[model samples]
Target chain A: MIEVAGLKKSFGDVVALRTVSFKAEDARVTGLLGHNGAGKSTSLRILYGLIQPDTGFAKIDGVNVSQDRILAQSKLGVLPDGQGLYQRLTPREHMRYFGRLHGMTEDMIEQRSQELIGMLDMGSIADRRTGGFSQGERMKVCLARALVHNPKHIVLDEPTNGLDVMTTRKVREMIQELKTLGLCVLFSSHLMYEVSKLCDEIIIMAEGRVAAQGTPEQILATAEESSLEDAFVTLSERVAQI
Target chain B: MNILRTIVAKELLDGVRDRRSLFSAFLFPFLAPLFIYGLMTLVIQQNTETESITLPVINADAAPALVAHLKEAGFIIEAFEGDPEAEVAAKTVELVLSIPIDYQKTMAAFETTRVTIIHDGSRNDTSATVRQVRNLVRIYSSELNALRLVSRGVSPKLMRGLQTENGDIASDEQRAANFLSFVPIYVLMAAFVCGLGLAIDQTAGERERRSLEPLLINPVSRLSIVFGKCLAASIVAALGMLITLGMCLGAMLMLPIDELGIRFSLKAQQVVGLIMAILPIPLLASSLQLLLGLFAKSFKDAQSYVGFLVFIPVVPTLVMNFLPFATSFWMYFVPVFGQSIMMKEILGAEPVPLLAYPAAALPTLLAGLLVCWLTSRLLDQERVIQS
Candidate 1:
């Protein structure tokens, strides 16, 4: 379980997040919905211990990671929004590197990397440097890396970003499979269809605060809309206007 | 065998894949040194050929026989009037060589006559003219000594001071070793320049290419990435230094030393001594350069920043060879300081005590490690990754 409480942060005078609070329960995919500048990525980043919040606490399995990050980040996996993997390293090499950092033995890394390679269908490119990989391939390689150490909690920011329609559908199906495996999934995205297709629960963020949270169908029914996009629009009027 | 191994392998693979970098890191090592040192040697050879200049002699006494003797010695001597100062400043004259008017009186009394040399130090031909004047003075002194010895009825051969002609009896090995004095300086310079290029291309080039973000997102600690790149740069630097050494020795031997007129001879063993003397300087220079390059946010920044390392060796090198310095144990540990001293020792200028080797090598290697470790820690900070 991951909990973010009162996540107030600022960059100079611009408030990036304000009193943000949410929880990602086990065995469910929680979709963080937001447009540009909606603080979705910021929230994910803060939870991943990449940046310290001015006044907030991000906990992973009841351990406050912002205070003692090394413990918190160890149990979590994050695929950052824009940042790609080191281009020089091959996928196999990347997996091994992360495995070692996460305290896995050389044999364990080799085994885990093999499993991930098979599951991800990236065996062919595993030995090749990631420098020349296509965007979708790179994204998948990042995904394989996230699972390399077999962390309990996964936090992905815009996992399907810059991906083609076919790749997006595959990624959505993968997320569903992850949920079935009882993994706690915390993913952020602006695409309504993608979020509605994969996430079990939706947490729509507007500006710096949580505007709504519930099952996609329930939220849509309450908002008197037939689609998740209309429901998001109904709840995020102020942010949409701004 | 480990994740660090994977990272290092990946770094090496990437280094090889980047063609521009491959050219700079590997090829430039051989080409750049040959070009630079070769060009330098050529320039020196051109400038050092014997020079000819006109000598102006001012004889206030108007001594005809002395002027005739000077003319016979191939000096383009010209007569000047007034006190030597007036003719010293005259145009079309390089120098004022004044023989005192009382030269005959002083010579009869067995007294030495003063010959004052005067010229504007800032003049274009001042150095050349001064050297010619000194040569003329020597010839004149030799003639006078010969004349004085004959008048005293002493054997002219006695003035040769027992003819005790001393030539350096050092073996070919020692002479070749002595020539190695420049090896440390050259290797350090080449290595620093090579590392500068490698570091900039690895660090700032990655950032510019927008490949840095993906690398930072990895679960691996940032230290792994920094060290990976640092090690790669060090390897490239090592390659360049080795190539320079190899090529220089090859050029020294294969390129016809007799043809080049460089009496300097360096064999394989002498090359090994140069390698030993220079081994530590590269670690010191390259590590510092990498640390500096990491701070650069752009390739140009890294390029200019690393450029400073290349020139740094100049001071230590020129100082060791051209300036007055005494070798001590402490000096060996002072980065280029130790290497330069050891190099001088290789050159048969063994003022450097052999006991100072440990004091010099250990501290320098340790200091380099300390700096490299600090750079690793600084890079591990997440803020640097995002930046």
Candidate 2:
């Protein structure tokens, strides 16, 4: 479970997040939907303990991030905004490195690495260096490494942003599997259809604030729109007017 | 500690696989020794060449006795008819001996005569040969004076009012060590050059690749991460320093330094002393590199900054070389300067005070730690990741 409350952050004179609050519970895929520059990444970064909010707090499993960042971070698996991999490292090495950082023993690292490679269908390219990997292949490696420690809560920032059709479906399926395993998965994206299909609950952000948030049925009823896409457009426009 | 170890292991593996880092680390160690060999060979060749001089004499026929004297002194005489000044000015000959046409007349009249040696005073390459010829002429003149004094039934000793001799105190080893004094500077430079690529790659290169964010997102302390990176860079740098030291020892062993009229040999203790003097420098160098690298916005920017930072070791070396100062105890507290002085002492076979070793290393290690601490603080700043 990940919880962010009254998060307010600013970069110089420009505010990045203003009064943003949301909760992503265990056993659910919670989607943070916003347009570019709508503060989704900033909110997620705050939740992952990478950024500190000026006001309010983020907590992982009720452990306050600001008060105990390391303990909070240990419980969270992060596929950050830019999933940068060491080009000279193989997929298995990547998994092993992150696993070690999480203080996993060698045997556990090896076991978890094999399990991730199998689940991600990355066995063919598991031992090869990531230097020449395709975009989809790199994404798989990033996801596998993030999941290596098997944290209770997972945060992915636009995980399917640049993936092709088949890789996109694979990622959606993986998220579904994580949800079924009773882990809290919070992801941020600007894609309406992906969010509508994958998320058990949706949080719409506009101008650094939460514009609307609920289950799909509740969100549609609140916006008085038939489709979720139209509801998001209408709700964001109302927030912009206000 | 385990996190630090893990970070160190990962960085080392990453650095070893980077061809650019490996190339930078190994290139200078191999080349510095070859440079020493080439330089020492050139000095030996120049010193040996001075023993046999080729003399270009204008009007050689006018001074048969003088020419014969020069021949007995092992001067290969070549008669030249061209203008002596122009020949020397053009560098066609090192120097010219002009025997005046009235040279025999003055000698027959028992009067002092002049033999002008035409040469460029500013040219150092031919100064030794010119000095040799001048000495030979002075000896011949004194001999002639002695014979004249003997014919007059007076002792030639009466003509010598005072005799002077030189007492040089420097040992042959010391002289040879002075010739290779730049060895210490080369070794120090290796400390800086070897880890440059890796240091920049791990810090600035990490930022440019956008990997720092993800790495920091892990539950590792910033200090552990920074220290780990610094240790990895220092390891490569230490390897470079060792290779350079080994190659220098090999070069000293292989070169015919004795041919240059000096004995040059490094004892096992002195080699050990050299290693002790330089061991702490790589930590200082890599930590400094990491600090500066974190400030740079990109890999190329870090490279340019590091290129400028290499001058840190060189500035003290140049200052010490050109404007020598009296050695004081406090000098050891300064990093490169102190190490350089210690290296000089070891190379010269002079006894170094045992305290001097830690005096040099402690400050360097402390400075390294300080820089690493500052780098960790920089890592905590949000701008470091945002940029």
* TM-score, every prediction: 0.73, 0.93
- Candidate 1, which segments miss by more than 4 Å at Cα? A66-71, A83-118, A121-132, A217-242, B1-3, B36-182, B208-221, B249-277, B319-323, B349-351, B373-383
Instruction: Give lDDT per model, in order.
Output: 0.72, 0.90
Q: Model 2's CAPRI class?
A: medium
Q: What tens digits encode model 1's per-residue C-alpha lDDT throughout A158-236?
A: 9888888877777787788788888899999998887888888999998888888889877887678887888898888
Q: Write the per-residue lDDT of candidate 2 for residues A45-143, one digit (tens) a residue.
A: 888777789999998999999899899999999898876889999999999999999999999999999999889989999999999999889999999
Best by DockQ: 2
In order of the candidates, what TM-score does chain B achieve?
0.67, 0.92
Error of 2 at B207 (Å): 1.9
Candidate 2: residue B88 Cα off by (Å): 4.1
Q: Residue A10 in model 2: shift from native, Å? A: 2.4
Query: Residue B308 error for model 2, in Å?
Result: 2.4
lDDT of 1 by residue, B1-387 (tens): 254666656666666766776676566557755775676466444435343334566674455666666566556666676555655566545567777778888878888777778877777536654775577667777778888989899877887866556686765544544444455556667777666665676666766654565455444555566666666677777777788777756654543333333355544665566676666666676668767766776678878887877877667767765776665566766767777667656555334555665667777777777777877665544444454
Report the C-alpha lDDT of model 2 over B105-178, residue by residue, as the tens digit.
98889888999999999998888888889999999989999999999999999988999887878788878777
